[model samples]
Target chain A: MSDGDQMTPSRPVRLATRTVAISVFLLLIAGALVTSTGSGLAVPDWPLSYGKLMPPMVGGILYEHGHRMIAATVATMVGLQILVLGFRRTDRTTFRLGLAAFGAILAQAVLGGLTVLFLLPPAISSAHAGLAQIVFALTATIALRTSLFWSRFTDAAPRAAVEHGLRTRASRLALWAAGATYVQILLGAIVRHTGAGLAIPDWPLSFGKVVPTGAEWATDGVLAHFLHRTFAWAVAALVVAAALALRKLDAIPGLRRLSTLWLGLVALQVALGATSVWTGKAVWATSAHLAVGGLLWIAGVLAAVLLARAATLSPAPAAAEVGEPQEAAA
Target chain B: MRTDFRSDASKSMKTFPASRPLWGALVPLAFLIAACSPNAPEAPKAPAGPAGKLGTAVVAGRVTLEGAPPLNTRVTMATDPFCNGQHPGETELPEVAVGPDGGLENVLLRVTEGVSGVYAAPAEAKTLDQKGCAYSPRVLAIMTGQPLEIVSSDATIHNVHAAAKENRAFNLGMPAPGTRYTRTFEKPEIVPFRCDVHPWMRAFVAVLPHPFFAVTAADGRFEIRDLPAGTYTVEAWHEKLPRQTFTLTLADGETATHDVAFPSVPSA
Candidate 1:
């Protein structure tokens, strides 16, 4: 209606947030379906098919074209979310996060095009997948922020606490955990795109050997597989450590519950990873493993962000910004 | 009201804010955008024309094995034959060159260049498909103007790399898992199709110009047809046997059959 109406402080309800979150999750599931069906090249030619807009969607063409269609829908809705943020005059953090998410969506689109034009080159495909994980994390973060837990997670008290010197260790620990989780996500991308999953045919032991020993170990195939397997071990260790650290700060019920969920997700992810290998890269199982990995990484990052925010929320010597609640924390 | 003060504060803070490196993200975005350019496979040349089809030819043979029943031997005739105008003497022909079970070896016949306005291919020419891990028909006879279609029926991939002269060479990949392809040669060339994927998979395609060829049976019997009522030289050739040549004349509406015995050679 009017400019004033656009700027009016109209807080979106929790139901709307849940609906958006569910939609994003469904989009991820659809993507997993595309990969599992091996429809990546259903439409061999890109940008146009058989020199027409609607080429016959037979064979691989249907899968690839369907993936593009769903991706476009996701991009449009995410863009709409950014517009809504602008119109609603949400928190400065919310507006900035929306802009970042929009940029990521555009980047993801470009990457998808590159994946096609490059004939699915392993490196670009891997990077495209890594960026997708980041987008998934961003959407999940937005959902987290809009939920009832948002205000508890973004408590602006952390920066003031660092200035006042209380609960400082907890904030630093959570930041490190978040960074580690991000690295784990990148490694998982490398594992999938390098075609290394089958290199070490047998699970745990590579080529019936303990260490994948020998001078040939320096090769890209061997190295990528070895690094991925090693990182799985590291992920297990870091996730357990992060959960323990969060356990020490049990006062925040939300963070504790999230930490436990994060640990459970990590365990499921590792089991899926092994099953993917043991099952000869069965399409359905591999896709499920990918999906769970994305959810686990997002959950890990969300928990770290929330716990760090809560750690900084301990009371201070002086009351500031009275009679006003802090903007939704996340 | 605190509104004016807050507006001024926000505006001033925005103006003096740190210069964010937009290129930090833009650089990677550009890198990703340019990632896969110039990587797709180039389109191949368009196909030349419609492929030729298979035709029928009447073949009959008679063979006489000396001092034996010629049980499991073969004799053949050819049209458009590769005689090269050369024939060996009858006395020089080897004895017992045929297999113990009466199997005949090399027989060169011709679908001679022209007969009654029709081209005659060399007799005794064959195309064999090493299909299903077994030779298709276990025997074949090919003539001129016929391009052989060698197919793989095994569940594994195979390559048909014909090792022959007088034809272009090709080492093509087969479709994976239950895939087959057909290729034709317009000229006579003995090319061996070998599967590099499965080196054990191999077949031979003999290209000829006319339709006159036969593979000898286990009984050493042979036949020649459409002789044009003229005198012509006949020869038998086995890849493993010394060749034998004979002279015969064909009259109109008459079929000529001959039997020749091949003796085995002593071990060196």
Candidate 2:
């Protein structure tokens, strides 16, 4: 009845949420494929491929059309998820989040079509990509919230008063890490859409220095590339700080493991980012880099949510007389 | 304190319902693997048409400049030191090449109208070379469905960016010398290719439904052979001059000769 009371979501609702999350992940990968292979304009006409529903699948058309197909599938899955959540789940937060995801996916589809119809304008394409990540995050959040682990963990555990400050700090830090990572990913989208990936022409060092020099500093492409790299370092630092904070808390059973995982993912992401520049944006390296980036963001958000749950369950001093020992048993 | 909480949380976590296995995760992976795999079916080839019969009529002609040819500015390759070093002194880009007596080279000539039959594109590929940081045969013509082989001959990287309005645009990177990339345009368009790395390197290609287009040579001569007898409008285009078009009628077993001249303007 209360926020601390665990409400078990129906199996169907959980399954649908998980499905939407996976679908969103796949859609993100498809989007990455389109950008990586330079196949955004492979299918010039949208909604219909070359004036037909099914175009001759070849060359860039495969990536473009396949992206459209994956998008459509994800849209359908989101629609279904929203229906299940609305009918079965009484909790308004998850229901509304599902609906919001639906709206985002619809907007994303429109943006995708407009991007093709308008000939891959940088703004529209970048927005489409940005929205995909947001939608993926939303779906992942819903999936995590609906999971049985989340429900039981929040309901059964009564955090000790001693752990309250640490949990709050960890939660806020994780939230900051997630927000910073999203901003970095958006910058990455700009760098990619503007063809700024090769602006620096060298990695680890921009134009053989920590910062761009001379004409490289003046060019927009080079500036964007440099910002992306700079922001990456900032994000890496934030991830490390968040990981350390979570490790110290160690109150949540799985939070420590998730933090370690974030460290590994961030390291892998940095390697992939460097390899992307070194390999001249090789398709595989760049695509993997994007996928890992998305995963890292997801990990950050999940850690924040779990820690916030722990913070909420921290025993209140005034409620100490209200069955504290039974709550501890839980 | 942490161990006490951990034991309690693990016990409660065990009581929690089992999350559903991620079966749906495999669907996207399958789709992605299938999309990226090389074993997918190839695009259908363009339909084959009857080959040209022997002894077909030919349209042969010369393109010339009527006045002093437009002076082409020198290409500055200072952005990439490698390209700049290739040219010892000032390197002038050959935009308008005019010989003695006003012979104009690099004029693109196409049969604009009156061709009706479907002409099969030759299987042999036409190559456009990137050497010395410039496109060889700056102006080229090909029939629709003909494969274009873009070969990079310079050590520096060059991206062949085809800016086509009617057809799909492609930007491909050739990172090493001797790298050959092939592309085919399905629609008729006058596509311009530029190197984004070296902004000054430019090339134009005209793709037509029929194989009746030709680019004028150094002596300003171009011959469109195997054109069936017909009254057609031939259009001549020069990069620096206005397009000129004229109607011509070719009779059976007759060789027609026509000269198209472009009025030249002084360099800016």
**Fnat by candidate, in order:** 0.07, 0.00
Clashes of each: 94, 0
Clashing pairs in 2: none
Specify the highest-DockQ model's number. Answer: 1
User: Tens digits of per-residue lDDT for model 2 on A238-260?
Assistant: 99999989898665677778989
DockQ score of candidate 1?
A: 0.05
User: What TM-score does structure 1 among the candidates reach?
Assistant: 0.52
- Compare the candidates by lDDT and give the number of the best one: 2
Worst 10 residues of 1 chain A by lDDT: A1-10
Interface RMSD list for the candidates: 22.1, 18.9
DockQ of predictions, in order shown:
0.05, 0.02
Query: Candidate 2 DockQ category?
Result: incorrect
Q: Compared with the real two-chain complex, what DockQ does model 2 have?
A: 0.02
Docking class of 1: incorrect
Candidate 1 residue-wise lDDT, B11-104, digit = tens: 2432222122422333344344434343211222222344322233233564433454222322221110111112212111222335475555
Candidate 2 interface RMS: 18.9
